[model samples]
Target: DGVNYCTISLNQHIPQYCGSCWAHGATSALADRIKIARGAKGADVQLSVQHMLNCGNVGSCHGGTVDGPYQWIYKLGKRTGSGISYFTSQPYLACSSESRDGICKNADTSCKAENIARTCSTFGEPCVGLSEYPNATISDYGSIMGKNAMMKEIYNRGPISCGIDANPLLKYTTGVIRGWSLMQDHVVSVVGWGTDPEEGLYWIVRNSWGEYWGENGYVRVKSGALALERSCTWAVPDTYTAPEKNNEIHCYEGGENCKVSAKDESTAAAPATRKPELWKRDEVERRGFQWRGNSSTPSSHELLFTPSNGFPETFSWCDKDGKSYCTVSVNQHIPQYCGSCWAQGSMSALADRIKIARKAEGIDIQLSVQHLMNCGTAGTCQGGEPNAAYQWLKEISDKTGSGISYTTGQPYLACSKDSDAGFCKGVDFSCTAENVQRTCATFGKKCVGMAKYPNATVAKYGSIQGKDAMMKEIFNRGPIACNVDAVPILNYTGGIVTAKSKDTDHSISVVGWGTDDKLGFYWQVRNSWGEYWGEQGYFRVQSGALALEQDSCIWATPKDFTAPERVNLLHCYEDGSNCAAAVSATELVVCVIERPFAGSPACLRSPASGSSGMIGSMFQAGWGVCLERSVARTWESFKKPENHANNWEEAVSFWAVSFAHELAHFESPLHDRQHGRAMEMSQRAVLPGLARVLSKPWGSAVGSQNVVHRKWTLQGSGGNLLG
Candidate 1:
């Protein structure tokens, strides 16, 4: 209750070990939230109860035999939920030096089996031991129970339809499959039969087996949550009667230019009143399934909602104009209509089609990433509905006929949420590595390709243009090449500055691109992300017919502008000063009017410090700028070694001498030289020496590759040299 720690002094007192699971350092804010939310304290304790549900539901669906949502407080009886030690927990043991994998050499160092397992796992593995459990089939019995209850109030949807293990051994067990749920391979559990904590009313609670699984399964939730989630297919039992599907009229029916006569339509209206259970759309379309095409609109098929318990009462759709019930149009992008009628008994029709495709394609595959990406906005995914790609790939894998142990001629398709528009790019799509080659060879192009929509797009990056990226002045904003041309706007392209991958080469990334804009675009593009360079790394392209497809843009500073012109020197001024002393020592200030897009210009001042001194501007400005002042003796020493210019080079050797000198100030390496002697950094020991502005050139992002250099110069002792 007392003030724990002072604001400035708080960081020093963090606890040594976490007090709970899936957490980080002891004192993190997440730890505090969990302490308050779950009444526990552990950094990252924010990995909630619902999130834990995945481990359970996923466990039961894949590994565990029994399942049910026993409360988080119940299932995780002891907070330390136990599991296969290698996957979920690490043993508190030391690895012998010989068994250390050469990663740890000392006795005090350690490595865990969890880390070892991670190293062993691949992207192909989503959850471990997925194939060990029996694959589940969706049961339609639940829907029948719901229907019987609706019409006759006979609600006996017990064990045969949906049952809980309910065994004493499985009670309060985490891995027990409590009951079937909506998602395929998705299962839920019954926590307890008790009054709702918030509602103060009796209810049966369920949990998702995911940490964030329920509202902690806390509400007076609806009955048959899984049934609703699964969207159970509705069909009448033998005892109940309904018209046969074959008797239903369809738009694409036999040899007919049929139109519903006014008299026929009026007669059909009588059925809705007689049945009282029929949907309105069904009644309207009863005369015939012939929908007339409007003069200005595409033909539309009215949807009839057919609920197992009753008829669909309404329909809806979205058009370009945002109308809920849209008229079908020429463009296929808009929704023509939506209705329970439209989908009436649609699930069965789909099931039949899937059975055929599965047998023909030999691809009765499971639900996966490919199914979702190209889902075309379909909200949920159910297996045995159309998944041609998954089916095709699964067939190919099966064709190889190698099960789990036999990772053979072809590897089974791996799924991921990252795949674009629902297709696999294969681990080695570009023929870059051996695995890619193996994958491609085994699958053929289609096997190594996307499953759905044969022509669906896979990658989205625009191709690169010219080579070496260079900073350029604002005036030359064109497709003007950089590396081979003038100056650089940004760093040379294809740079691997901050490597994120274990493979150093993969660290390379495209930094920025150039365009043919007269001025930098993003004039109004402002964001808190990073500094602006052609609208914060984004450039504009001409969209009209004749405009060329522009890919990259690079800019450079004119080498001539770095130094003042003879005329400009005669004008007599420094970066921001004017020197009047003819032969006396004085400070010379240097500055650059930055090219707003790329690279920093090096500006060095001379004389270190001066008294009563007004020096001329050291550099100039024009197609770039020209240097100022007549003191030719002061500015020449820090140039480059000009002998070897044209050949490709390393990041260190090829760095321009002038650029390096500027980088000296930029990195502020603790120089052995005379300048910057009095500079004091917060942690002088932190930086070993001056930092390197660049590490290596992996590729180019904006400009060209070629560059020109300047030779080094010298002046009197103690005199400042501006390169």
Candidate 2:
């Protein structure tokens, strides 16, 4: 299943040598569990270890237990402030040389003004003030003593922090570490568990050491071998606060504030026709079944069917044959259970279709559900229409050339427990336009640029009615975004579900259809819930059941899918002396070159001859070249001469040779160590190539053109050449 889940990978490297495994293990596990609980909203949160190292009563550096960090986080509440901070906020600074095992530097111990000043200066941003920094409090924490219990907790929640004897692990570079040691010395977070064919079984444990330490800062330790299974702990975050519900405030159609109470019908009478509830059918229709979405209309493009010949025995884009035309199926749990399924379903379907149209090459394009959730004009966490989301995609694509961005560009942060209305507080959705503009200006760009195949217009999309129509569309095109009654399906773990219901509440993707011997026919559907909830983020629905075949189903075809071409352009300068001129010229060149090359290319001037220098380098470094100053000076000397033919010919020949040498450097930054023979050959080739071009005199005459050569003057130089 394509559920966008976040992983708890340790990004912070303990400075120099510090045995803060206790801090690292506890913080890592807590943060991972929080993100998982939030349905992996793509929020990168690294709980502060420096907070525990400096402030916690835990035995620092030498050794400590998982209980110390857990208790500290529980009491002080981990955050970026005096007591705690995010990894990016405070970062980790190894204890001072003067500070011994139990002793800590005064600066490391507390949030002093000098410490705050230093942090601000280092990061070039205002320190997360003592008051401004928010705390992540834990309601309760306990130890998972047994190995089975630890595995169960991790599977149910997320990672668990545990103690392990890490002396044998010091030299561990790779492979599953298998050794039994009850003398637990260090702590590490058990992120996940996996079994290797050769190595039997192992636990994916996260280490504090930098990425270069283990398997990218993680280790696969043998299961039940080390003391890791002996001790482990887990905690629950107190991030959930009940949403404020005001029954008196009646939100009318179009979300207008009518200011009238629900009981007062005399003011502005509630619409006689009940608006179709697009979310939480079981809850919305608690009293009686209410219509969801407009009455399903028969698809205009529906194929003429033969009653005698039913749908093909079984068909699925995703099957056992490994020949899947549909893009890799994905799942998206709107972080915090936000009721944006309408938007999620439409975006997921369209993005997947786009991928299939593009032949499922390279990077999988995950269109931003958050973009549709926050920026889209449909409904908010308070439910929305799937058609409205499709319409939003069309409108945004028209306005922004490229459709909405990928997930990383704009991540989903609107986390809410209530399916009725989502909470947008403490999210990217709260950023002001001015703040966004200022931040973008500071960073030198706004948004994640335009997408290559951004304009994904629904060529022809309509409600897919009946099982045959849905199956036909899936077999022909790709997956179809459809609504299903999920009230009973929430608790469903495996097997074909056959819940009888006409009320369609939740939106999901019908990727394919298949049949099982025991369960009969079924639809392999992908849900937005986390992978832990269903069969690895996918569930089989009983064919023709749950109002799936009767209700709304959208089939979209990606329009004009084409990959963007790559084009590299560089402006060659005579010498690297004109640094200011090169910088000014590059800014203009980027715009000019970007038109032809849809993707942004590096536009920089070559370094002056001889000296290897990076003169006109952009913030994002790219390849640069250095030309010989003598070559440029020689070309300049031939600008105005008594012998025009000789001088011009020599100038052109030298220019070509210099251009080839610099172009080679631009193309391949790594120098060819095959002596100067290759360079000599390239120089020799340039003259002949220019001679061949010059021989074709009429080649340039294809169009009516005037050959008016201007006298070359080196920029930033006072006098004319050869003066």
Root-mean-square deviation (CA) per prediction? 32.4, 18.6
Largest lDDT belongs to which candidate? Answer: 2
Which model scores highest in TM-score? Answer: 2
Task: List the candidates' TM-scores in order.
Answer: 0.17, 0.39
Query: Over the stretch 72-176, how does candidate 2's per-residue lDDT look in tens digits?
Result: 766764443223444422334444323432112322445342122111111112322222222356878898777689878988888888999877766565669
Candidate 2 segments exceeding 4 Å error: 1-311, 320-334, 415-423, 426-457, 560-723
Residues 1-723, model 1: lDDT tens digits: 211110000100001110111111111221222222322111111112112222333221112212122222233323433211111111111122232211112212122211211111112322111101101111122232342342231212111112222122111322212333444321222222334444342223232211111221112223443342331212111110001112111110000111122223321211111111112223334423212111112211112122455311211111111211110001000001111111111111222122222221211111122222222221111111111222222333345431111011111122222221112322211111111111111101111111111111111011122222211111111112111110111221111112111111000011123333442211110110011112221122222111111222111111110001111111111111122122111101111211111211222223221212211122112111222221121123222335333332421132233332332232333576313421222112101111111111112212222221222222346332222
User: Cα miss at 670, model 2 (Å)?
Assistant: 58
The clash numbers for all candidates, in the given order, read 89, 12
